[model samples]
Target: MSVSATHAAGPPAGGPPPSGRRNYARSYWLFAAPAAVVVAAVMVFPWLFTLYMSVHDWKVSGATPFVGLANYAKMLSDDRFLWAIIRTLIFTAGAVIAPVILGVWAAVTFAGNFLGRGIARTVFVLPMMATPVAISLVWTMMFHPQLGVLNYLLSLVGLPPFGWVYDTTTVIPTLVMVETWQWTPLVMLIVLGGIASLPQDPYEAAVLDGATPWQRFWHITLPLAWPFVVVAAAIRMIDALKTFDTIYVITLGGPGTASETLNILLYQTAFAYYDLGYGSAMVVVFFVIILVITLLMLGYRQKGIVT
Candidate 1:
């Protein structure tokens, strides 16, 4: 007995028969529909609603009237909002720079053969595992003006007892210190991975030429490891910009709103003051800022890679 012409052709070249393909596609869509719906519900709807709210006069109890760009315009002349942007930028800079510098140094040091290296690295990275809220609480106690161990240590060095987070001038630096201590290990790990993957030929050549340690680092390790540094900086920048748990737990934007970054201000506006429209406007701006920064960093990284 011979098979029919259509049956001899078998399935299509790429996959199953037409009907089977249709069934497979149906199954694929069925499996993906729940995730798509979830994303639409959780992300898409919220973002769209926020954008909608941003162009309206949306209060918790009052009528939500569409007001065009009035909410966004309000941010332009708002002193507190402008100051919040400045503070946030400053904090992000400190957070990114301090960690990158210290982390690179730590990576360089730990990359060499040393006794108890594993234990030391573990101790350094322990802070990264700690919860921000818990770390903030512990740091808060240590930041006390008079009774804090930090102040006592300063006194032992014949230095004046300084305010850690209380004074406006010192508050940002104090927060940055906390951020640096907790996150430097992350940068170290990233850079160390990069360093580990680096070619040894350049270092060998430099050593033969009698290059100093500093020269070798500057001429070789730094250029090769820069891309990793950029990545670490980008992560830290985003994290610092949106840092809330630690800042909220510690200062709550206190000392006359001296520590009020955009996140803190946004929280107060939306939840505390119930001004949803203005808060939404702030959110849009905040998102744009983050997006721009991220793009710039990625562009730089891409450029570096290409070169």
Candidate 2:
């Protein structure tokens, strides 16, 4: 119980020794090794292989010859690839902007006390829960020019039957509508959390000052929740850039290459045409595009957080 005696006791009963700490560290790594191996196998190796393939001429059948940027050069020259880039930008813009706007509106509407609020929110998010392929299939049926319910409704309103995905001019926009419908709820949830977390002091002050609903939202709520909106936009932008399943199921980039985004063209090149090398190059480019955009968005987010 004396100080000297206590010093000679080394440490308290449950205190770990250096040996135990070493063993704990070893056990930590031991438990982590399987996950590390799985990550390397599934992610790292495939990425390295894709990079290697991108510099080669591999068609999965014949010789895999190293061509070194030839595939990239070819992509630059291919008009279809150029068009795919344009269409991807267009689709991504529509998909992201529409969802952000709609989601913000929905969040603001749902943030109030209302009857059946729970049920209404549940119904609103149903599209987000549905499988993309299944939704695409159902939408395909509804998009039918003649027999579809959409066209039938149009007829009842005295509007003519219109091509949804069947026309090249409308395909990308149509797909964007699908993307917006499915993803707006996710954005709403994110913004709603932000809105919920906002301090009520500003709103109360604004109300006391005789501020209108639009003025309160414009001057206070939107500014406070802007970061959350930006986060939602970044997520939506990334997802929109890589959309494939819905596009494949709905249009298959059809009516020409009008609906062909980078993802669709890459799939066609790699799987459909069996041009693995070319597809690898496209993947590399697509990854770079995503990386740059993500970095910019994240930087903006950090700035917002800091400010």
Reference-based lDDT, each prediction: 0.94, 0.94
| Per-model TM-score on C-alpha atoms | 0.94, 0.93
Model 2, 76-181: lDDT tens digits are 7899999899899999999999999999999999999899999999999999999999999999999999888999999999999888898888888889999999
As for candidate 1, its clashing pairs are none
Residue 196 lDDT, candidate 1, scale 0-100: 93
Off by over 4 Å in 2: 1-17
- Residue 219, model 2: Cα distance from true site in angstroms: 0.9
Q: Candidate 2: what lDDT?
A: 0.94
Candidate 1 lDDT, 168-192, residue by residue in tens = 9999999999999999999999999
Error (Å) of candidate 2 at residue 48 is 0.7
